[model samples]
Target: MAPTESNKRLALAIIDFLGSSLKDGTLTADDAESIEIAQSCIADTFKVDPTDEAAVKEAVGGQSLASIYSVYEKLRSKSTPQAGSASTEQSQTDKPKTGAPTAESDKFKSEGNALMSRKDYNGAIAQYTKALEIAPGNPIYLSNRAAAFSASSQHEKAAEDAELAVSVDSKYSKAWSRLGLARFDMGDYHAAKEAYEKGIEAEGNGGSDAMKRGLETSSRKIEEASRGTEPPSEELDSAPGASRGGGGMPDLSALAGMLGGGGGGGGMPDLGSMMSNPMFANMAQNLMGNPDMLNNLMGNPRLRQMAENFGQGGGMPDMSSLMSDPNIADMARNMMGGGAGGAGGAGQGGQGGQGQ
Candidate 1:
């Protein structure tokens, strides 16, 4: 059979490609001599000049020979062998098998990850779905798809995929973390907390910092719901003396003075009246118990100065200064209940009673 014009052109293109590989350093200096020799041999056999720009262009047909060969390889890999007559091998080749990642499935997963990096959640989902089709019970694929779903704000679908992933492999900590995040986004705090706990258990070495933080946040939310308190907003708009529109810190000016324990009169004020206010009492007790809160308080130079002033009977610490510390501000918002009481009169009378 005579070689077709296209086949001749293809051979020319191969020779041209080999020359290019050497020039472009694709073939290292060590292999340059061998590559040049191979290119000359191919050009001689094909009766083509690989260095002839016009001939090379015509042979390449606007696309590189490497690209064309890549297409050929892909098609060959996907092609299944046919049998003259039906046989067990033929039947098995036709039969669809699913489970575990194959090379083909892994390629899809890599594509999905690339799409995810580009924030193409829909495209990533499609690629992940293709991978899952080839490997149905793959926890990693399911977890990746779940992350894509979550990124797209499809919380329900994300939760479902995450749950399936965890069910397939309970020890998959990332899957459990995804499940917890999905639940948390859906406002299912208790469920989120449980999932985070499971994730922590799955991670033998005390779990990742992110997982532990998620667990703490979920637990805080559950506690807030039970205590009928709203989580602190990003901006603490309801500080002391701010108009009480459903939420605000109570006036702590007098309580601050009492904490200082009266100076000129020289005696500690009776704390009975101050402790009677549930908001004040609860906050005081919680603040005293919280090591983090105490540490933050003691670490702040301004706060420590205010505390010293109170001890020297310096009256109320400046509300503005006290609220400036974000830790104290958040604590005040989270612990303070919506209640009002006359602490000024209480402080004065308690001071008098103690002085007598």
Candidate 2:
């Protein structure tokens, strides 16, 4: 018989025997060793080696006899014959027979990873689902399916799968990270933080660093939201010039000092002096002259208060001296015409001469 047909026949016989052993609870370590040896024999007969470290990982499923048979079948199918016709026939005869799973869970895992890489999350989920069906209670498969659910934005489903994976194997760091992300999406920041911390604890500081950072960020956001602050930040409270009253408005004295110096001697003029300035009076009149403009410009409460201050003649500085200064007068003349001399025409020629 050909190697493929021999492998298939052996696999059937092993599966049959394993099934019977399950009901009788007669599957022993010797039986498991026998299956492993048969798998190795099939691999060698086909000139293939079962040296893949991943292949040696936890058997496709838990330590059930049927699952072991499934693993043996998978190994035999993967071991392709490489010899000539006569040698192939001899190899097949020398190979041991065994049973295997109806499906290859590892293949499903690989296909799911490939689909995930392509961002076909739903397709990846299907592959992972198939893998879980073949090897139920597989922590790795559950974690992988959880990742697919997360990518598809099915956060609730992702959380459930991640929780199952962690329950299956508490040390599964990837599953813990996935659980954190799902919980974070569902607005369970505290739970997410705990999950991420658990992941970091299991994997040390290596593979769980990103999850740790995520926990820190989620904690900060939750704190900020609880405090009713937008544009969240950890250092917001320490910002310079920030006021109390939940960051309402700056104090009036602070605003005044910022606009100009205060109280005498090179400081801004007092309210009476400012109101007496003709230029200040002109600007004030111009602004209040238009009711529509005033309403539109002072719609904000803070701005309206500032406008009221300006109206009270307490806010403005003395501008009369500035407007009347000789340099300013000359500059104004030059601007109105081409030169001070032109603006000061013939009647004021002597006045320009006095400055010269």
lDDT values, one for every candidate: 0.70, 0.59
* lDDT tens digits by residue: candidate 2, 195-312: 8877887788554558769779788878977788555565543432323233333232332333342354344565445547776454334333322222222232333344355556
TM-score of 1: 0.41
Clashing pairs in 1: none
Give the per-residue Cα lDDT of candidate 2 at 33. Answer: 67
Mind giving the per-residue lDDT tens digits that candidate 1 earns over 1-356? 75677867887888877777878878888988888788787777767766677777677654467755653453344333445634335556654443468888899999999999999999999999899766775789989999999999999889888877776667899999999999999999998998899899889789999999999999999988987775555665433221222333333443454356433243444556557778768866544333233333334455557767867768767798778754455545544521223233222333343343
**How much is 261 displaced in model 1, in angstroms?**
39
Query: Against the true structure, whose TM-score is highest?
Result: 1
lDDT of 2 at 54: 35
Per-residue error for 313 in candidate 1, Å, reads 50
